[model samples]
Target: MNRVPVSSSNLSSVGYDESNQVLEIEFHGGRVYQYFDVPQRIHQELMNAGSHGKYFHRNIEDKYRYDQVK
Candidate 1:
């Protein structure tokens, strides 16, 4: 997936696959993760959020199945 860089304390970038409902997040430390069964609205909200990390924690984390990509 192609990811776009974002301004965040812990996150470096984010990407989404609408067809597959997968959300990929890359952290500053170089760790990347893909969250499954995600909604497009959530991905859009994350991109528009003031704090990506906060929004992820509040709405996404522990809410979907995920896998580490890097």
Candidate 2:
């Protein structure tokens, strides 16, 4: 199980569980997403985005490598 670090910046709020390779993201609109099979580098890129919150929603959430929260 990989152990990815979680960023604490207010620009983004996301959690990753290495055991299952699941990524949990909380967007600015209060929308959430759980991404599966996400690579560590991609996760870091997502967190490092200038607009982390918005990028997650616009690019990743329900589009790229992630699905909407159940």
Candidate 3:
């Protein structure tokens, strides 16, 4: 997966592996996490949202299985 930097106070960057359905997120304080079993639609919405942090909290946080990568 290729991570792309985003404009968000609560997020640093984001990445998605479509074949595996995994969504990777890097937070402001150097925390990294991979959320599994995420749909591509959700990923796209997150990317296009006005507030990445808000979109994540409302749609993704605690909604899928995840693992801390850093």
Tens-place lDDT per residue, model 3, 1-70, is 6799999999999999999999999999999999999999999999999999999999999999999989
Model 2: which ten-residue window has the lowest total lDDT? 1-10
The residue ranges of model 2 lying beyond 4 angstroms of the native Cα positions read 1-12, 57-59, 63-70
After superposing candidate 1 on the true structure, give the runs of residues whose Cα lies further than 4 Å from its correct spot.
none
lDDT of 2 by residue, 1-70 (tens): 2233335343336777766667787645556667888766667777687766565656656654667773
Candidate 2 TM-score versus the reference: 0.55
- Highest lDDT model number: 3
Q: What would the per-residue lDDT of candidate 1 be over residues 1-70, giving only the tens digit for each residue? A: 9999999998999999999999999999999999999999999999999999999999999999999989
In order of listing, the candidates' clash counts read: 0, 0, 0
Select the stronger candidate by lDDT from 1 and 3. 3
Task: Rank the models by TM-score, top first.
Answer: 3, 1, 2
TM-score of each: 0.97, 0.55, 0.97
